[model samples]
Target: MLKPVELDLSELGELAQVIPGPEPKLELSLSPIPQFGAERPRIIPVCEPSLTGNELKYVTDCIESNWISSAGHYIQAFERAFAAACQVRYGISCCSGTIALHLALAVLGLQPGDEVIIPTFTMIATAYAVTYTGARPVLVDSERETWNMDLDQVEARITPRTRAIIPVHTYGHPVDMDRLNALAERHGLWVIEDAAEAHGALYKGRPTGSLGDAAAFSFYANKIITTGEGGMLVTDNEELARLAWTLRDHAFSSERHFWHKFIGYSYRMTNLQAAVGLAQVEQMANFVAARRANAAYYTELLKDIPGLVTPPQAEWATSVYWMYGILVQDEFGLTRDELRRRLAQRGIETRTFFIPMHLQPIYYEMFKGERYPVAEDFCRRGLYLPSASSLTRQEIERVVDTLRDVRR
Candidate 1:
């Protein structure tokens, strides 16, 4: 049975008041989805991709053309379109977002024992990618306000071994790229943006991916513009792209087929994936609009609900609201996990924030004494609600009402 909702318009006015002043930036983009509200006005996944586009058409064309492999026109088209959209000069498609990061480090020739700064609150893939290059991921705590890397903590961590900084734009919100970039420029370090969760988000009126030296994106099925399972690395440096192109295809030199100039893993994105990705990119603007609207509605409905801290926006950035996350304050009478269980019983699916990299089993021994209070606290209290691009306004109300019911 569908529950009727009383829409709240009053709290919405608060939005305008918080609208960021110009420090710099612009836009949010479109994406894919999986509806979990099946059978019983059912479960709503934490994030879903909106697939209302020419996805089928373009994919069918690739199938008909028999170019489902890596070699095809769609590859170039997707690369060009995504690169242009991000205001970068080149987009080198890869097998996954993790590989995209690996490619960035690989091209920079990150040798063993080199250090790459990263936020502890990010997805494991960020750190894993650093490991892929035999480099150390120097983890830092997130800032409490935006749940992004604490830039102040970064400078102190840099040593002679530090080579790059990979800032995962946490939860679709842009990090303080200007400050990070300034720090990097001072230290002669590279900035690699792990923009997997932020496709069309902006910082200071500019796209996030372009703010760093090399940006990595994921086309996972749940991303804004998905290719089911793919990733891309965009940059303005011609030599870097050249190196990546060769690296993506097993390090083969252009002059010779099957001859290896260097040892490289095959990280190429298939033509079929590119075909779907092109269609998804074509619909990005609309997708971003839907996501923003959905997030706004969520904010409106949950405004008066005390003890819940909704996602915060920074004045210097435009968030994509990748997943409508909230932090359950201690006063809330329920633990974050407890609330999630309650929502699960109501057929609402939610996801907890990342376990800080320092706490992960694989990295525990490596970071035994290191502690990041902000990141650890978020891990304990943060969880995102249903934030699929395909979510409806009514669905947002249901999620809010259900949450209210849970608290009651």
Candidate 2:
């Protein structure tokens, strides 16, 4: 069981005095108000999709044309548009981002017992996708600077059985793609980018998805863009694109009806989802701009706080700041959990960074408490602020003010 930590905020009185007016009350009483048309305090979600008015028109067109299923024009349009945006030759839409990763693994010709190196600090789906392809997931620790796979550790883990590398762009920060790509080229290994959180992010002016041999993107509701639930796989190779297309729909062939050309899974995306995705894609540039601006605002507001270490942007990378995360300094004498609870008490939402995969129950039983100190440290110290695209400047100010008060 996880032990709870207590937070003492008495020291914050000095900091609270800096902000104008009385500090907000840390508690509120519930009122029995009517369900409809009642004013409530604004909620700053972690993310909110930017949907322009075109979504309903496209969705209605899909429904009216009786193309709401997997085989439809909207799906093809979305695939093409996304491929063009990523600067890749082809794109395959899948039911979800996890399936996109699985398809990339399948098309890479991974076999049983082969290994794929992945960051231990990423989401569980990264490892699961490799498992689905009958390949073992070899976890590597993250670097303290960027919260991404440490290239040194990755190189150390590569062996005869290592078949590929999946470098994830954690938050909106791009991984060290040049180093990872060079390593893959040297080892003759495939590079599959897990770009789930970096749709519009760039590295040296090139898009994240275009940096690898193949890349997977998520359009889940919490992402910078949403399609309810959807994903896309992009590749520049024609053969790989054809393979992904065939494998995503159960390997059906044109010449042979009901005959399977290869073993595959049903991972097709519906037209309804694609319609929503297409609309979101059209506004991706604007959404990315807003996210970058908001990140700048937060940095300007909180840079002076001695206990907070804001997210870093590498020289070669331009992050969209999908979520504004900070590492609480040890000098602050407070744990991330303590800070999270204090912020929550002030009606501010925050989230902790992902725990290293090695610490998960299943992985822990498999690896037996092997240490990856940096990843573990990040899990304990990193906290994410509210970064919804819908957040107004006033709301962001309130959040910053609350954080400033807690730091005192």
Candidate 3:
């Protein structure tokens, strides 16, 4: 069993007095040995892609073929491969994850006044996508255990205006898909999963994208796998895929040029991006494995710390651990902000978790007086550790050591 160590914040404050404040660091460093070279400050980003030789080769092939625009063989190849990976019938590539969500809403024919249930603890894009479709986003609190949408609260929030539910797999942890899907089925509501943060995540032996009617993914620079900037929508419905494709590319009819069938925005993915995506997709399994390994290492290092709670994996959910998180307990004697500041002074980069969207200014204006106490409290205390894939074992050790020192 792990023994918890109580943190002494009073000691930390006194130590901070002696600790030197932030200073401007040199941009580069030089060494006398020419061949040995010099070292630069390594930036441990939150997430990074692990590229393979095939990625470069595919880009070279795209250059050689001159299929560098939005339409190319690489696009179709990536879509097919990604769809296969997700165990879905079809996949449509788009310009961004947000655009993919927008496409999902549009393809589903969501209209003004329709209500979409979203988690308050997710990236703003989830709710923004619903708003883009001229629908209202009814935000729900997260489950304390998994940090995903609270299923009971979601069920309670459903109304006559509710048209869909977008359960975000936050930080690559799969939500309670079985329960969410069951709720959707019972209510006859559309299930469009906002899986932007969970590419290879699984629930009950099935991939996240395959668990819903439709799902969206992101390939932004910081994601586990990146295509520079791209996204994808996966679905088993052929007609929905066709609609998404048309809507992605200006809603043009395939039969004729410039034949506008419906009003749509140009959210197409370039062949170059798709080429990069195909390369990244080929390496996703390894990337996910590495991330999981890193999370395990973190858990082993910090599980004994008192006043700190590491992310918990659900019984039926297998998380990719895109970002390792730690919740500072009230008894810790240190606020999340204070911990973040102290870590920064030690040359470690850390970030707080998402601020619940329900408390945002825009949402406040819309809802006027609504409040989610649990979501609000979690946001005030949760902090994300440095879990970047580029982070080396030594760096992780340094972070853990610093954390241990602070607690002591």
Candidate 4:
């Protein structure tokens, strides 16, 4: 039973104005892609990249300059820009968010049998990254308030082997970083932010990436700021950044071209991707603003709906609302899946929340009989609405209207 946070009506009204023109129709003809014929029903996507920026021009430059591989100027430019946005000094660009997490942990020197604490409610990438370093990911249930790792339970799981704690800002809501940092410091543990979905989020006015020892961000097609398929590790630690940059490109020793000092990876982001990333970075502020505005309006419209729990933004956190999620309570008369199916029938796309790590088939046997009540509860009830930054007010209204119609 998570209590909803109070929505700031004044702020909501102010931000809602940022949304551009009228609401878009729920339908989108699928004629553009040759795969889907024009007959395909127009569906409002759950998430989509807004590429109205200089993505094309930057990409064309990369191609013309013959620097489209991983070694172009755009890569460094994108990295620096994104790092600055996080208020950090360094950014190590990588091929994907999971790789960024792995690189961060690797630089921290995680060893086999070491344990890293993480929320069971997060995407599997967090756990997988820890596993990549041969370190075990110790699971913690989520707190109801922020739907983030329960800091209260974290201490109980810390043991001699616990070396780090990866705090995931669930659904773009910043976790209580100060509290988590204090707890980690007391235990002599490193704090790594799993900020893959929380671009531009703030915790007590500080950017999320700068709050931890190191943070990972995803630039996937559906993320707040996309590079099509890329990620970055932002940090203030020079040594960590240096090591990650080296390791991401096969750890080729600088002393000699062919010599290798450490086992490394081919986790490099191409300049082509960085081109798009820089374009996206240039528009990150607007993207974040749009997401916050959309979340505010969605909350306002959905607040009156029975059994629907809109996402929460803690007083100290300014959530980017990466995906505008809602929890379906038992009183809703319809199960979460039922609501999703009905939404789909109306040509609206939706996505279910992440299933906890303990419930994942790959990790099931390892965590057999382990019950993280809060994470499991979220999995059963949570679903995201259309949450793209490109969403117009009319589009949001339509989505809300569909929810109301289905509930009836």
In model 3, where is the ten-residue run with the lowest total lDDT?
24-33
Q: CA lDDT of 330 in candidate 1?
A: 81
Cα-based lDDT at residue 240, candidate 2: 91
Q: Number of clashes in every candidate structure?
A: 15, 2, 0, 3
lDDT of each residue in 137-228, candidate 4, tens digit only: 89999999999999999999999999999999998999999899999999999999999999999999999899999999999999999998
Q: Is candidate 2 or candidate 4 better by lDDT?
A: 4
Q: Using TM-score as the measure, what is the rank order of every candidate, best first?
A: 4, 1, 2, 3
TM-score of each: 0.90, 0.89, 0.89, 0.90
Any runs in candidate 2 off by more than 4 Å, and if so which? 1-40
The best candidate by lDDT is 4
Taking all chains together, the TM-score of candidate 3 against the true structure is 0.89
Candidate 2 per-residue lDDT, tens place, 1-408, comes to 976433222332332221122223343223111231255555455567767658999999998999999888989899998888888879899988898999999998898989999998888889889988888889889888888899999989999999999999999899989988999999999999999999899998999889989999998998887889989999898999999999999899878878987997899999999999889889888888888888999999988878788998888889988888998877766666677666667567777788666666545555544567777777767878888777777767877876776667
Runs in model 1 lying further than 4 Å from the true structure: 1-39
Model 1 C-alpha lDDT per residue in residues 1-408, reported as the tens digit of each score:
966533232422432222112211111111111243333464567777766788788888988988888999999999999999999999999999999999999999999989999998889999999998899989899998888999999999999999999998988899999999999999999999999999999999899789999999999987888998999999998999999999999998788898887888789999989988999989887877888898888988888988889887999988888888999888888878778777776667787888777766577667766878788778778888888888888789878877887798
Q: Decide which is better by lDDT, 2 or 3.
A: 2
| Error in Å for residue 79 of model 2 | 0.6
> All candidates' lDDT scores?
0.85, 0.82, 0.82, 0.88
**Candidate 3: stretches off by over 4 Å:** 1-41
Q: Cα lDDT for residue 70, model 4? A: 89
The number of clashing residue pairs in model 3 is 0
